[model samples]
Target chain A: MINSPERVAPDTLARVQAEIERLGFRPSRAAQSLKQERAGAWGLELNSAGFGRLGAILDTFLIELTTGAAERGSHVVPFTAADSAEPLPAYERLVASRVADGFVLTDTRRDDPRPAWLEAHRVPYAAFGRVWDDPGITSWVDVDGASGVDAAVRHLADQGYERIGYLGWPEGSPVGDDRRSGWVRATTDLGLAHPEWQATSTQSLPAACRAAAGLLDQLGLPGRSARPGRPGRSGPGVAIVCASDALALGAWRVLVERGLEPGVDVGLVCFDDTDIAEALDLSSLHQPLDRVAERVLHLLATGPDSRDPAGGLLLPPELVVRSSSKPAGNRTTRKEK
Target chain B: MINSPERVAPDTLARVQAEIERLGFRPSRAAQSLKQERAGAWGLELNSAGFGRLGAILDTFLIELTTGAAERGSHVVPFTAADSAEPLPAYERLVASRVADGFVLTDTRRDDPRPAWLEAHRVPYAAFGRVWDDPGITSWVDVDGASGVDAAVRHLADQGYERIGYLGWPEGSPVGDDRRSGWVRATTDLGLAHPEWQATSTQSLPAACRAAAGLLDQLGLPGRSARPGRPGRSGPGVAIVCASDALALGAWRVLVERGLEPGVDVGLVCFDDTDIAEALDLSSLHQPLDRVAERVLHLLATGPDSRDPAGGLLLPPELVVRSSSKPAGNRTTRKEK
Candidate 1:
């Protein structure tokens, strides 16, 4: 046994390998790699407690990610971080223990510490959301929230309503800012500019309702036309664009309370086409999570030794128009605003 | 060096161990156990594609389970099962590869092949739902759906609605049947025995809506008092206990269409207190999933060689009352039904 070629006879090694293959006795990842190769899993650190209101969206994204990874013969190892403020300890443990080959980060925020840690450790990873302040190159796949609001503006414009109002989350959220930028860009191109109709608040139903109330009250009955050649028309017919379906739900309730018909009097658009949007029959932007998951895996598959820099992908959001954005009639009704 | 105790000097071993501890250098789970003691992970198989409309409820349950597992110092390795019929392949791979020490199974059904397979393999595991037909000893933690529905029925009875109806999923489903049986037991106890008032259908909003419509039509108005001295009742004065919140949402819509006030004219109760229930303000049965998860982990911690037989737990569901089940008035108004 000691004098065998390379510690084991070549013929014996080949025979054992063949028998192992024949019996389909697959070896564990650690045993197969001699503890040097892939862990055969991907890490995902989640703030299980922090996703309170947005848990549905995050869960759907995770499901998609898991399905995509399974198709590629991998598993997603979900670990919990005590809180969002400190998520690095779990990632550190995962990497140090070689529990996963790489990771897929979600809920990326400003000055996020995860990307830098992974990068410094030479670990392969891809983020589902973008870090706003990070200048470093990284792999990420994000849906363009701004373009979603822009499309909503165009859709409402095509329906003959020009005065578009924005109801979004407060100033700091990268996602909220991106969505608000879409409204800004779309309205600028259309020349139906009414900047003062914009409103901002926290990402909650009550907060959105209060912000929507303020915007609607300020956007009260249109007295004069903003666009030229439409003197007969009242002020820009108002359409409210929200950062999320939750906000849109609140905005819809506000409209109902004010005796203003949603599809008839005001156009409402919500981002993140969740079931709430479907139940409420509100127009919303649906992110193609399956496609996003596919792209994320493709990016994360790059090994740490790869020479190429980390990649990035921005997917388009599909706008689903429901009764909330349906036109009441021809452009002639613009005067009724 | 050759004569050292256990192949290493005691002083050297102690110094190295102290340094490792001081550096907080978490050795890989494999290295920590001489690569044998524990995998430090648990297997959780999910059918991302098949959940469809019921995905939200499952997602919440998983989140709670993840939190509970994290508290116990373990990570959840989520994998995708192609379909419900064949969830064994993933579990087998996980166990044979030693990727996970054990599993926490969910969505267990009648004649489930999982428990038997795990038993045959002598793999440590516990199921979140019970096996209806399995006589073998197994560990499981399940919420009593029947008891949940019974509570809903009783809550409605106390609110002055003696003539209660039931809406549930079709027969053959262990969960659906269990929930339906609760309605049976509770109504029988209250002496409001109207078995004909029960309805069943697939679990969906439209399907439940159709079933609710049919039940409402069949139970048009109170012809004669099932109870004495309620002749002045304007309608049947019935409340519908649903197998799930999805069904309750549909029933609530039907009530709105029929111009019947949910809280005043009719009572509504839904099982599985999902966010949809909270959003629509319909009372529902809230399962204590955190406790269930903790129990599941405790059971799974037991190895196959343990002397104790497999354990089972049946936790009660708590009913949350919302505006949907408010009392119309005292028994004096019972005649109005």
Candidate 2:
């Protein structure tokens, strides 16, 4: 009767609820689960390499997911795979034991085995990244990196930066290529295409610095004198858009070493508005993590088949403008005012 | 009979186990919980301010805890308090619903209500930080910040640094004060007491930079000529020990702006060997998170009564040597070799 309040009379229901509150009575989760045939929990696999490192966004997403799960009268069970390369065993264990009713997947990559295994087993799951191996799978929500970078490029152009260059990761990574495509698209659209102006590096700081230094040389930035054989588009109006905050830090360090101010000497922007970006006052793209978490939960609750026929949701990131994107001329004019 | 193999005949047990494995007949967790009267899960509270920020160690700790719990045939349920200041209600909710058998606490602070509330209710719990409110509470595993800072100060002094300055957070935080105390003790012990050389700032980069810059000016560093009437201790042999990686970053920026390289120009060390420290190559104190996680799980399983009467555990942090702690003179000698 208490479980189904509608079955009781209104007056009796109120009286019984008051008495239960007075007695501090509550049903045990185990008993409730046994009756409901559900775990009331979701399994989240933690791959140390994917998160818990510096400047990773998954930690924030985990917090949001945990909070949202609690609000929806469920709990999040965090676990880790003994072997990250083959994580199906861990997922299978959780399912076999009935510890979780569903799973939330992250760090999605090409040739990933998880989506196929879950689908074959008829288990419910939702991914935070695109299910790269299967286009038919729409149970995922991811931030559109390409559109985010494009927006950043357009933002720099609007700020009057004529010679815009890109500092990005090595080609072949899906995310890296996605972000680079945005730069290519935006620059081509704006009639400021300089395909030779960009440089690639690994995520390491030193490598990024070396790459950024080389890119700066190609663009003829931080030096007023133009190279004899290179293009004449150089100096204060030049800007660089990085694929991530770590890459931006490298570029920022190089700019600092050359005695150049980020906004005044040259405009700068990067992806993933992490603390590094905020600390350095660099412009960046902010991922809509809260919306992503909400959508993932919604997909898990309402199976993919019950959802709209549309494909995976790709939300555009919002551009966060800071002092790094402001030109020196604009700052001087504002000061004069 | 399968649960208690000793009660069954050897041949019967083997045959039954084989049949169970062949059929993949694993017992349901909900049914097991109903029979065992335990949730088989531990609750972990996530306070956004306490973690999920840049350069925080809590995210790493969560991963370790999750992995440890799984090894012990348990799960960790992460939740958020609706009201962080008064988290007892959330704890009570979990207890009333029996969603978790015990709780694992983090970010323990002075006058913490959770310990007292848990004690009153006889709920098992363990903390990652010291339970500051009551001396009798021994269910905690904490990193000795004071000893870590002390070791850092001694390391700088051993490196032939004469004027060692301290960069720390504003007073009143228990953890910050504990770390600060180590610097005071170490400096006095080493006959290099200069209490006046310390500066405090919040965790923000700009505030830390301002504080660090002011401290450097007082020490007369980054300049060859000493200020008239001031002590002549400003030179390449000076060093600074910071309370955290964030503060060290501030001091690093100041040094970079003045064209002074870390280790070679000024020796530096900070606590929490986070990713920022590794990326910047700064020497830092590494907390033993794996041991901490193992101990926390032990406490949860054994309960407070089964443990030794000795107080809470305090593990010392290990110092990770990197380029930031090496002296310029030392590097020059190595180059000559």
Candidate 3:
């Protein structure tokens, strides 16, 4: 009845569309692939360096993406680096060999040569991360890291933690920079910006712990005065936000070693809600990789011919509030033995 | 020089052959593939159930295998389950479509229908796990879990831990059963067999922790006694072996909660030397996944034409000795706060 143009009114059409959107109706991809002669696979070009120490976010994302692809009656064809410096040959071969219908590019950076190469060759691709320079070249799906961190910082402030600190990766890393930029935005907006409180380190548990310890030690000293008109509230309610779960885990350990209660004395927010966070019951920003995969698959299936200029989708991350971020006296905060 | 039959003496040829064997020369796969008209891609059929949790072993193996394949100028084509119970359609399509030269099978079980299906269809395939029904049906590369656990048990006994318990997954898992068999063999041989001391639980950290605590509390109470020859040792030296790193991590936490110092009052050994083992400094059995990948790739490249009766390779696992396996007197173990 809804499909009949003669009987269905404009309001009925709108209501049906709204219901479909609310219910998240995805068309059967197996049937769609059969109808369109789809290759039923998408190629993913992985960085060789990532294989050394598998990133938890990337590992989980891959699993979710594979599940998403399998649900859609498709699969992800992984192609690794032949030459790390020059990966164009492998990309060219993938196109020439017809192994996959399209590609999904991950770990996108500023001035990334991949989008250019893909544009020049007119290969169908959907990037998982955004490129800085020619946004019109390809469709992409990126988690709004800046917004995620911005929300995380605000949440910390709302938890009554005034002296919030941030631990992030070193400069020049686009991904880390994006996350830090969010913290910057939040700190500035909240009137809690502390230049001495910010720190950077390599993305390892040990390195992050050291950096976090340095930040915490330097945070609540005599030289660091309380805010104007707000005495005796300088650093007792300190909070720390990390760019990743690894850094947060490190900070948690440092806090424990320093005899400061994590959830009561210091609020902690971690990006990437991996298994570690779950095990430790830490608050974290969870990226919706399943939705991202769905959107990326949609763009890839649309192909290059139908490429739209404003096709980039920036999805918001959900904040999972656990015991780690609860304010003092909150029953949700679990006591450490 | 050995190529020249007329100029080279027989003794010289023999010496050169011995040197070549010592050097461990592997022929370039690119040249071999070119001469043989290789499809340049291998198929991997992944189960949907495995995708749910994304086992760390499988994840690492995939990365290593993909890297190995890329180094050999080939790529892995992963075809996942469209139907969980019936995966042959996907395999049949891969063959009918000529998208892959051969397949690599993982997580093989008793009376697995896949081997028989491939055999009847004349599809070239190599398994990563052993098939119990007929060893001669196909080539396989398996990690010797029995030997790995046997070595772990002996190492614990050597560490002055007389009563070594095993925490493993519930019955019906082949891999878990294999590891338990090793423990049983070692316990029976060492006269420390206590049937009630063994416990089984789910593979999660919390479940394993609860199970570990139960085993520890129920042990050495009344019924369980020290080995007949060892009258001096009662319950002084107690240790545990886990089937995986997750379980080991749980056991460590339980030990800590009970105020017992790990690597001091208790010994721990985990299988799969993943990041957790390194981060926690627990001793583990490291599987030779790189070598396994090498052997699997070799069998795949050989195709079904060169199927040998005794082609199965069961590689022994290497146990890495760390502070966790060290005896109480050893000062090498780092003291926890």
Candidate 4:
């Protein structure tokens, strides 16, 4: 038996409106053709570079999106570069066949070539993310990485830590760069300088750990005295904020092992508060994935140029303070373990 | 700048053929109406019933499956039961929309109603698990829960525990039932009667701890000479094989607090082998989710009417013995910290 509305998610009621809209629609051409013929016809298109979890994430999201379309009495045929060595040919063929209505595009680079390609060919499509150099694209929804980063840094600053440093990601990644910008802006507001102590780390946990140690080591010596009354209380009580909680957790482990109390002597924060953050009790900024997913789906549903080009939306992130960002030396700190 | 074919997901490539056919054939009048007025479309359908991590896993599989479609330059729309009060409506609407060319379904319950619904409507779709009863719908891929349970129980029993009890989920869940049956079969074969210490718990960690204690209390003091056994061998070495690693960890916490060493004096085993399992060194069964996802996607891409008379496909599970289920009285067992 199904439970009450209170027990169910809020999204459960959206179908009624969709059903209402469908009721007003005319009979499908496919239905007429199927009655006259036996074969089913449908089309699907996909294009992107593959990265493990990323590829995995994109695949799952697409399949799920398509499943609903299928239930609505449509037959979807999937298209991808997997069918051919070159993605351009498959894409062109779908458009040329006039069998597919439009294309769905993802992995759009900062200076993506596809938006112009699709537009020049007069094909209506939606983008999973935005392309910076191309302004003529029709519709697109993207995660606002800058705002997410800003939230992470702001939370750390609010928690009373000075001399914040950002453990950055690989150079030139648009998303990573945006997050790093947030960190810089936050630190700048406090009139703090970016020290050479900050370092870069790849996504690996051990790499993040090393980067964390590198940052603190630049402070020079575990028991060293701060340079007199300029008053940042410089010994070890520095805040280390990182892009992606993965690096943060890695850095956190290193701090714990170094005999420094987290939240007291050292502050650690990470972006993207995922399951790992919850498990390790790492302080982090939680990105609104649901909101992002909804926005992306909305853009994908509607063609590019369907919405206002000048309007961009940014969702706020929540900060959850665990042992990693709290002031150390308190008795409650030791008891947390 | 996004690299194409060399970086594409290979499995997704295989399904692009069907998309090619869809793009090539406008088919009949019904097909034309079903075709997009502007572009190709597919979607992600989030079943409204259980919207948690398992749901995420299923969603990810679908997204991965569609990677081939996207690469081929087709569009898919992800629509879920977020608005539908139930999963059945989402399934039904997917069939009616005429917007999707294919469908992907998952989180099949023990007695699912969606399979028959899909079959009756004749919509081709893939399922992640089999419904225990239906003969009409045929096509599903699932993890083999029984063998996983069998392997875990036997491993624990081999680790010098004479009598082990099955600490499972409620008596009815298909996964739980399958695992418990395996546990019972294994223990009985090893010449131990099924003990009455069977207890169940819901989602809470504290509740699971209570369940463990209650189950042990039901055993009626194993050290007494009430039954045929050696003096003071008490409590069957008390190996509690749990349904999931999360549940096992919950019960283990309770065991530790109650003067019993989890890996030594009291045995524990869990399923899923998630991140926590490795971190806590909990012995567990590793179900190959990545493989299961692949097979599920393959079946969906191939038309979803796989294995006949219930369309069942079983995948193997492996046993990973950690410190959590060590032999009773092992040197590694800490003396009740």
Q: State the iRMSD of every prediction, in order shown.
A: 5.5, 3.2, 9.0, 9.0
Clashes of each: 7, 0, 0, 91
Least well predicted 10-residue stretch by lDDT in candidate 2 chain A: A222-231
1 versus 2: better DockQ goes to: 2
Q: For residues B176-228, what per-residue lDDT tens digits would candidate 3 score against the true structure?
A: 89989999998888887876677887766667777887877765521113222
Which lDDT tens digits does candidate 2 get at residues A1-337? 8869989999999999999999988899999998997898889999987787756888889889998888888888888999999999999999888899889999998999999999998888999999998999999999999999999989998889988999998988888899999999999999999999899988778888889988988877633234222233344388999999989988988887666778776789998898888888889999999999999999998975685469889999999998899886566443210
Docking class of 4: incorrect
DockQ of each: 0.31, 0.59, 0.11, 0.12
Q: Give candidate 1 regions above 4 Å deviation.
A: A1-24, A49-55, A196-203, A206-238, A252-266, A279-281, A303-311, A328-337, B1-11, B14-24, B32-34, B49-55, B213-238, B255-262, B305-311, B328-337
Model 2: lDDT of residue B321 = 81
Top candidate by TM-score: 2
Better of 2 and 4 by TM-score: 2
* Global CA lDDT computed for model 2: 0.87
lDDT for each residue of candidate 1 in B94-202, tens digit (9 for 90 to 100) = 8777777788888788778888888887788878888666745658889999888988888888888877988888998888888899999999999987989978877
Per prediction, the TM-score for chain B is 0.85, 0.90, 0.80, 0.72
TM-score of chain A of 1: 0.83
Cα lDDT tens digits, model 4, A71-171, are 43333445555543345666676555444555556566665566777778766666555666666543666666676666666666676766677788877
Q: What is the full ranking by lDDT, best candidate first? A: 2, 1, 3, 4
Which candidate number maximizes lDDT?
2
Clashing pairs in 1: B232-B335, B233-B335, B233-B336, B233-B337, B234-B336, B234-B337, B235-B337
Poorest stretch of ten by lDDT in candidate 4 chain A: A48-57
